[model samples]
Every structure is written in C-alpha cells, then in structure tokens.
Target: SIRLPTPISKPDRSYRVDVYDRPQLAAFMDAVKDKYDNVDQYHKLAYLRLLAFTGIRNGEARALTWSDMHLDRDEPFIDVNKTMSDNTGHGVVINPPKTKAGSRKVMIDAETANILKRWRAIQGQALMRRGLPSNVVWTNQRLSGRISSNQPREWLLAAIRGTDVPQINVHGLRHTY
Candidate 1:
C-alpha cells in the first residue's frame, strides 16, 4: 500500500522584471518606425507605441477594437473592458475583466492617438481593397482580424536587434509606461 499526500499551498514567486529607459526606448521606436516606413509593417509601430503609452496588458491591447477607442474625441481614452487569452496556445478567446479594477479607461496622448489614426488609414485602405471590414486594431492587414500574442515579442526582437536597446519582452513596454 502507498501513502497519500495531502494538498499543499502554492508557493510565492519572484519574477525578473526588465524595463527600458529613455534612450533605449527611442532607439527601439526608431527601429520600429523604420520597419513601418520601409516594409510597411504599420502594426509594429502602432503596437509598441500604444503599449508604452497606456500601460495596458498584452491581452487588453489585443482585445481592443476601434469601438473601444475614442480617438477623435476631445479627450482620447480606451475603454478596456475585455481581454484576449489563450493559455492552450491553440486559439484565442475574448474575456471580461475578472475584477472590477481590471476594467477601466486609459487616456492616451495626442501623438499616440495620431499614430493610431495613421495606422487606421493604412489598415482601412487595405481592408477596402480586400472588401473586408474588421475593427481589430492589431491585425496587420490579416484576414484573421486579430494578431497572435507572440507577434509583439517578434516585433520587440526585431526592434532591438543590432541596436543599443536591451533585450526585453513585450511586457516591458507596459512597465516602461
């Protein structure tokens, strides 16, 4: 016969947090801008700027649609009510914030809003060309209408490569805000 073990409580955790300072951030943004202008990857520039300005989580940003943003209004703000999560890595699902605190409005700077507007124009033209209408803010002209969570990490790597910027995950953009 074997003895059975009792349930145990979860242990505390320590995470290594890395964030970028001013110069590093500028370099990364410049790199992303170059990609956006040279290769026309508009989403790369828009994504990093939004995360850095808003301090919102990855899921929150991914779940956002044009309806959630009031960019043209006098006071631009994002209504962060839902988030996208895919723990299984097979698919993504939209979910409401588990806590009341998770759902709130985040104000964005004018330049950030302008960046979004420019991205919208570019995306809008492509969507019109394809005769498909999608409100997803991070699609990058994809028919899928939404971007995978890993996409941002790929952008980060590309932006930091051969640059003075330190290696950091997409979450670091939020921390830098």
Candidate 2:
C-alpha cells in the first residue's frame, strides 16, 4: 500500500509571500513607458500604477472592466467584484471574489485616473477598428465581447521581451499592489 504525507490542517495557508518596494515598482513602470508607445504600453503602465496604488491581487486587476469604474459618481471608486481563475492551460472562468471586502471598491488617484482616460480612448479606437460590438469595452483579437485574462498575460509577456524591465510574471504587478 502507498502511504501519503500528512495533510496540512489549514488548507488556506498562503504558500508564497513577496513584498514589493515602491522604488522597484516605480522603476518598472518607467521602463514600460520608455519601451513602448501604444495602447498595450498604456494598458501595462496604467495597470502597474493601479496595482501599486490599490494593492489588489493580479486576478482582480485582470478581471477589471469599464463597468467597475465610476469616475464621476459620489464614490468615484473601482468595484472589484469578480475574478478569473485558470482552468488548466485551456482558458479561465470568472468567479466571485473570496470575501465581501475582496469585492469592495478602491479609490483612484488623479494621476492613475488620467492615465486610464488616455488608455480608454486608445482602447475604444482599437475596438472600433476590430469591428467589435459598440457596448463591449474589452475584447480579444477576435473582437469577442470580453477578453480573457490569459490573453492579456500572454500579450504583456510578449511586449516586455527585449525591454529593461525584469521578466516578472504579469501577476507580479498585482503583487506589488
């Protein structure tokens, strides 16, 4: 008979914990801006800015949509409600966050807000050029209604190649947050 190792009592214990310093994250964002000049560049730099400022998880950042953003409302916050989890190597599925607080709203600073506005304009044009549906704020190359988080991860990785920025996983930005 095969013997199994004793199970950990707390299944939810976090296995890895990495803390990011502000200067390191700032340098990464600077590198991103210096390397590219397009919507992908804006998306990544702004995403890093949001992660550094908000301290949210990578999955939360990947799952973000325009519907979650309220720039002029009384709250003027981002609602982090849903997340996407990898379903093997094929794709991902949208899931509710772990807690109500995990689904809470995060306030945006002015600098980050301005970056987002520019990104939105560029994204809008890209979507229009792709012939995507008007109501869809995000889409994949196919002009699908919504883009899966995996696609962005892959794109960011490709974009970061040959750049000075460290080869950190796309989730590293979220970890910085």
Candidate 3:
C-alpha cells in the first residue's frame, strides 16, 4: 500500500473564482444589507442573499414569484422553473430554465427564508400601492429582466467601498455558496 500527500483543492486553470472567507462574507453582506435597507431596498438584500446562500443565478432570482417559494415547509426551497432573459431581440422575457436539469429545487437556510418572507410582504404591499400585480420576487414582471446586468456588481462595489473586504462579483458570490 502506497501513501500519498493530501492534494490541493484549488481549481488549477479553469475559470475559477476566488471565495470570501466567513468574516469577509459577513462584513460584505452586512454592509450591503445596511446600505440597501437604509434606502428601503429590501429586495436587493434578499436577492443578494439568495445568490450567496443558495447559488441561484441572477436570472432565476429575478424571475422568482411568490408562487414559486415554499418557505413554510420544514425544509424551505425555491422552485427554479423559469428564468429572465434580457438579451432577446424582442426585449426582456421570461423563459424556461436554461436546461432540463436547471428546473429543480434549491433549498434555502432559515435566514434566507425569513428574508424572503419579509420581502414578500413588503413587495406585495409595494406592488399594490403602484397598481401592479404582486408576481415577481425581485421586481414586477415588466422590469424583471430589464434591470441592468451590472447592478449586482455595482452593489458589491458599493458595499465593499471604504472597507477592507475584498471585492467579488455577485456571480462569484454564488460560487462561494
């Protein structure tokens, strides 16, 4: 029997992303939550957390609806059946997940579930006041896919501004999960 040294785990050369350590993650998230919440941007925090905690894609998070969340269950999950597409020639559109395998359950931790639950109530009220249907989680259907693709990265920068927490894009945050 031959014994070998433990192998390194980092991705060698693929399109790998750097991950945030626990404290860095917490600090960045705290800053994002504080800045957004101060301006009443509840959905942004929820969206960010879902990406970080569940690895859900931006399009999928944008396309989420109250109907797609099962937050009351013993094990809460998001039903990722649809995604938002912004690059379509016609305009932003909702379509099926990128692949058959994309349509699956994404279980979430309690903290994320609570954030979503509170956001749902807030979103419902907001949509009602605006005379829009409370359908999507992140935004109304018309603006779902229209949000600038760079918004998440911008949010990350804003949160990390004046802080030592290293900057990372939202997609990379998903990889951290």
lDDT of 1 at 121: 89
Model number with the top lDDT = 1
Which candidate do you rate higher for lDDT, 2 or 3? Answer: 3
**At residue 143, what lDDT does model 2 achieve?**
50
Model 3, span 1-177: residue lDDT tens? 999999989755343237777887898788878777742677778778888899988888777788999999999998999998677577778899878999999999999999888988877776677677556566634533335556767777776777767767677887788
For candidate 3, the lDDT comes to: 0.77
Q: Model-by-model lDDT, in order?
A: 0.83, 0.65, 0.77
Better of 1 and 2 by lDDT: 1
Clashes of each: 0, 1, 0
Root-mean-square deviation of every model: 4.7, 5.6, 8.8
Q: Which prediction has more favorable TM-score, 1 or 2?
A: 1
Ten residues in sequence with the least summed lDDT for candidate 1: 11-20
Q: Write the per-residue lDDT of candidate 1 for residues 97-162, one digit (tens) a residue.
A: 989999999999999999998888888887888888788888844555688888888887887677
